[model samples]
Every structure is written in structure tokens, then in C-alpha cells.
Target: MKLCFQNDNICVYSLKDWVKLRKEYRIIGEYLGSSQATPTLPIKLLPEEAIFLINKNVAKLIQYPKLLVEPTDDCFKEYNKLQVDLQQAEQKIYKEYRKKELKPYIDKIVIAKQRKLNDSVSTSSVLNEELNRMKVTQENIIWPTLTEPLDCVKGESIEVPKSILMKRTTPTKILVFTDLWEKGYYVTCGKKFGGDFLVYAGDPIAFHAIHIIRCIEDPLKPLHTSELVAFGRLGTSVKKKSVLATKTNETVNYITINWLDL
Candidate 1:
């Protein structure tokens, strides 16, 4: 089972799990790690989203009951030793690889230098010294590592009960979201669109949002005319339908609001 970690909040730390969730399940969660403007993983799942995944048996939520133990003095020493070892290993591999790549170039350079010396005042000792110096200069060249940080670190899964997951989000919001999701629409948080969710017919990136969905927990609750007009006008401006989603018993209902110029 794919495991999502629950720290301060529920999040999918693994890039593989996140890709599957978005591509397969159409669960597009917010990327909330380093560089929000230019987002990188791990992505954060909304409470409703987390609960939906749990209910569907798509993923298991794991909660760390206690904070990770702080590193001991010995641990720091071991880590520094490991870093030094890694640097040494990298340097050795880099030298071998670079030597092979730069061999032809170095040969060309050495030949040119020898030809220049031959034209001027060439001696066997002087030529040998020049070649040795060139080789040493080439060997001293340092290149940066191409390695990237690991996507996620695997840890022991501490299974959080389904009942506990249920407590994280409101039932009405889940019901509305699940209904839309089951209908094959891609849904993402619609705060920017001034709604609870932005519903797209296909991949959110490829298609324009079809609906700006606002979840209404109480179907019978009264909404002000101004609020309705604002939603409708905003939706029209963005070329999307404003939809109010609510649940009556177990059935979810959608009401579309259209703004008219008249």
C-alpha cells in the first residue's frame, strides 16, 4: 500500500506516490515543500483529499506518534566521516571519468605545445617537463557532482485508523468532492478562483476549468443575493460555471449560477 506521512498535516512525501495520485487518481494536491513559487515535492493533500484517499483504500496514512530522536555526538561524527568518504569516492570516480573524456583534448594540447617548442628551441628534458605540467593541470580540474537529493526517505509505517482520518474533514465537503471526482472531473483547490474547488473536464493543465465549485454543507441554508452575484460574475469573467454543491441525505446535488448582462 502507498503510505502518505501525517506530520503537522497529511502529505504525500514520495514523488512516485504523488505522480500516481495525480495521473491515475486525479488528486492534484498543493506542493508545500521548499520553493512554493517554483514548487518541488513533497505535495500536501487537503484534509478532504486525505480522507477521500483513505476511504477509497488508495493509500494508508502513517502518523509519527513521537518526534524523531535528535542525533547524538557519535551520530554527527559518523555523518561527517560518511560525507568525507563520499567526497573521496566521488573525487576518485570523477577523476577516472574525466581523464577518459579529456584524454583526446589533453593529447591535442600537448601536441600543439610540443610543435611550438620544436619550432622554437626544443629539448627532450624541457618537452618532458612541459608535458608533465600540462597533465598535472588537467588532473587538478574539479567538476561539480550531478547527483540530486533523494525524493523521499522510507520509514516504518505507523498506520492511522480510517476512523481517525474521518475526523480530519467535513462530511459534506467530502461527499461533494467525491461525487465530482467519481464523475471523472479533475478537481483542485479553487481558492484563487474564489471557490472551494476548480473542476476541470480533463488534466487541469491542458483544459480550462469548467466549474468553480463552492461546497455548501447545508443545502437549505440561505445565501445572500450579493454573494450569489459575486460568484456568478466571477465565474463568468473566468469563463467557468459557478456551482454550489451540497448533500441531501446521501445524494449530492449541484446548482449552477449564471450571470446575465440584462
Candidate 2:
């Protein structure tokens, strides 16, 4: 798998590898592409995710030079031409379909219009002309689904660098994630829930997250009362249990906090 380092995140550019990682390995990386379109190639992995994959020998970390290049005038022209050609081809096919499918409806419309006008206009000609000049609405246009796999970039493999290490995901966080993942739970970033990781009983798509995990790096450290209350409230509001996971030299421990309202 091509693990390209881009903008402090490890990215997988190959669609095949991304699908395999997500479906088989349960490594659900965030898709950084357009939200309007179905997710395609190029998914950015969190720091913890990249580290886990690297440690497990699932993917190698690499520094790829020339990751982005400026397109030339010819490239822009070719792209524009391709877009136009696709539009034309789709329009042509849809026009034929509309002519056939909408024939009865259009004929009825033409006949009614002629009757209202009390004229001898041919409905066939009118229907033909209307269908020929019909404009395809945005809803009628179908966007192509991109399922093709792209060529993976082979960059120079290097040891995990300091720059890739994020302050948000500490060693303890990784340990917590690894522990939960090894125990048959699907773990994902929990920034949305104001936690370190969200743990699911099974595949995330099939089951709702069961716990919002926050890792305490120091086993002896205690969370402030307000912080603990807030974390518990957040989990309650999101319909999940709040869990504080702390790691000692030998093992990791988890404590679930339940917020009760009187």
C-alpha cells in the first residue's frame, strides 16, 4: 500500500487499498474528497491510525516527493474537453430515452394545447420539436460513480518521524485505541463527541458507538470535577457511556462514568 504523507496526515491514494483497509481491516480513514460526491480514492488517516497500521506491518510509512504538480494548459484543455464530451454523451442518451418514455405524455399535452387553441397543428411534429429542445435538469443528469483503482505511489520508506506525531494523540491514546481494537471493538476518532476515541461493539456501520473514550496518560492523575461532569454529560447526551482509559506500565484500565440527574 502507498502511504503518502501529506499535510501532517497519512493518505492512501489507491482505491483498492482503501477499500481493503476499510472492509477487511476495519481501518476507517476520513475521506478528504468532495462531500457532494461519493467517497473515492484518497483517504486521510489519523495519526493514531497510521501508527497502528505501521506497527502491524499492514502499511509502510513513506515520504513522497512531488505529491502535487501544477497542471499545464494542455491538461486543463483535455479535462474541460472530457467534461464537455461526457455531458454531450449523457444528453444524447437521455434525449432518446425521454423521446420514447415521454412520448405519450407529450402527445397528450400537444393534443390539449391544440384543442385549446382550436387549430389543426400536428401533435407529432410538436411533440418531436418539444422533445428535441428539452433541456436536461440538474436532477435528470447522472454523475459517474468512480470505482476504478488508481496507481499507488511508491515513496521512500522511513521510520515514523517526530513531525507525524500529533500532540492530540499521545502514546497513552494509541495504547487505549490498541487495547479496545484488540478486544473486538471498532475504534474511531471521537472529536465529534469531545473524546479521544469512539468504541463500537461491532462494525461502526452496523452498530452505534457504545463508549466515548478519553485517555489519561498519567495513571495517578485525576480529572477535575467539572471536566469529569462535562464528559459524563456529553456521553449521556450522545447516548453513549463516558469511559476514562488510563495505562500503567503493565496494563490499561478503563472506568465508566454515568451522569445521573435528580
Candidate 3:
């Protein structure tokens, strides 16, 4: 598809292309007006969005978002077959949805965030030990692989390069995000929260974010006290811890600071 980069977000003006982006790659964005008066098509891409497409080879960067396209069947077969059953205890599976989700690590338990629990299945207290360990509370988890519904994945999965993606963002930022994913914690971009990431200890719908982390690539970079003060205040105001993280070879190191009353 062809999306022009504008105002830090990619813009697509064609209906066919827009549908392909939405239905195939599942790039979610805000839709502008199609009225006769406001005959403009604008879809806002959040920071790293266009690049996410680029790194996945889904979209290219001619400046920001200019990619080569290969006509692939948008069929939902491969993604449909992704759910696996444990041989010892076979159970059902589901793909659920929420806005702006990525499968990220394939081996991890896929959690559908910010959406209502599926009516089809309730959380079963007595599940196989392995299933309980994976933390899939219930079924109905649909993939956003191809369509709007959660748990849906692309029929032809996009091969994203970590090196390509990390280049667009800071090492520390990716470090914290990947680390959280690996550690079984949920994280979302904290653009609105005045931080890099909002750290959720558990399912976002069930629990609120416990921390707001700002990433610093260079560990030696001096942090401004005023900046820390502001972040600490904001985190406390929202009842979340304010954290600063730095990237290293081993893992991301985190430091939390609280605002002092004195």
C-alpha cells in the first residue's frame, strides 16, 4: 500500500489501499471525514507506527512510509491455525481484540487488553496446570492478525526485524518494552501519561498500571531533577510509580523515585 508520511503520521487517501491496510496488516488509526465539504483522507499513525510497518516489511520508508508491496492472499488460514492444544489436556482457544495490539512474542500467552470479557467462556478456576501457568483466563481470544476482532493474526505473518525496529526507537525504550513482555508484565505506550510506558502488573482491564517508566539510553546521562519531580508528581497523581530505565547488555535496569513531601 502507499501511505504518505505527514505530520509524524502516515496518511492514506485511497479506499482500496485503506481497506487493505486495515483488513490485511491491521494498522489501526483514527479515520477522518469523507464528507463532500471535507474531502480529505487522513489517518494518524502514532510514533513508531509507520516504522513498525516498515520493519515488518508491511510498508516501506521513502522518508518515513514508502514500502514495496507484494500481492499476497489476505486469507485468514495460517492465523486461524495458530491456536495449539496441549496433548495432555486438550482445550478450546479463541482470538480476542482491543485497539493497537501486537502479537510481539509468539511464545507468550496472548492477553486481550482493555476489552470486556467474552460471554462465551468464564474464567475456570480448575484448569490444567500448564494452561493456568500461561494465564489464559478464558477462551474467545481472537487475533487482530487480519481483521478488527482480537486475537486475529495475518494469514501471511509479517517478519519483523528487531534491529530495524530498534533503530527507529531508543535502545532503552525497546529494552524496557521487550523486557516487560519477557517478564510476563503488560505494557502500553504512555504518550498520554507523560512517560514512555505505563506498566501493568496484570491484565489491564483487571488491574491499573503500577508504574510509568521513562527510558534513557545512556546510563551516564544526567537526569534533570525538575523532570524527575514532574514525572514523580504525575505518577503519584495517577497512583503509579515513576520509573527511569537504562539499557545494558544484560537487561534493562529500573529506578523508581517518589516525590518527597518535605
Identify the candidate with maximal lDDT. 2
What is the per-residue lDDT of model 1 for residues 126-238, given as tens digits with 9 covering 90 to 100?
A: 44444344332223433222122222334444776766666766788888888989999988889999999889999976998999999998777899999999999999999
TM-score of structure candidate 2: 0.76
Candidate 3: residue 148 lDDT (0-100): 21
- Candidate 2 residue 139 C-alpha distance from true site, Å: 12
- Cα error, candidate 1, residue 20 (Å): 1.6
Best by TM-score: 2
Off by over 4 Å in 3: 1-164
Q: List the residue pairs that clash in candidate 1.
A: none
lDDT winner, 2 or 3? 2
Q: Where does model 1 exceed 4 Å of error?
A: 34-37, 65-154
RMSD of 1: 8.1
**Candidate 3, lDDT over the whole model:** 0.55
Measured by TM-score, how close is model 3 to the native structure?
0.43
In Å, residue 171's CA in model 2 sits off its true spot by 0.9
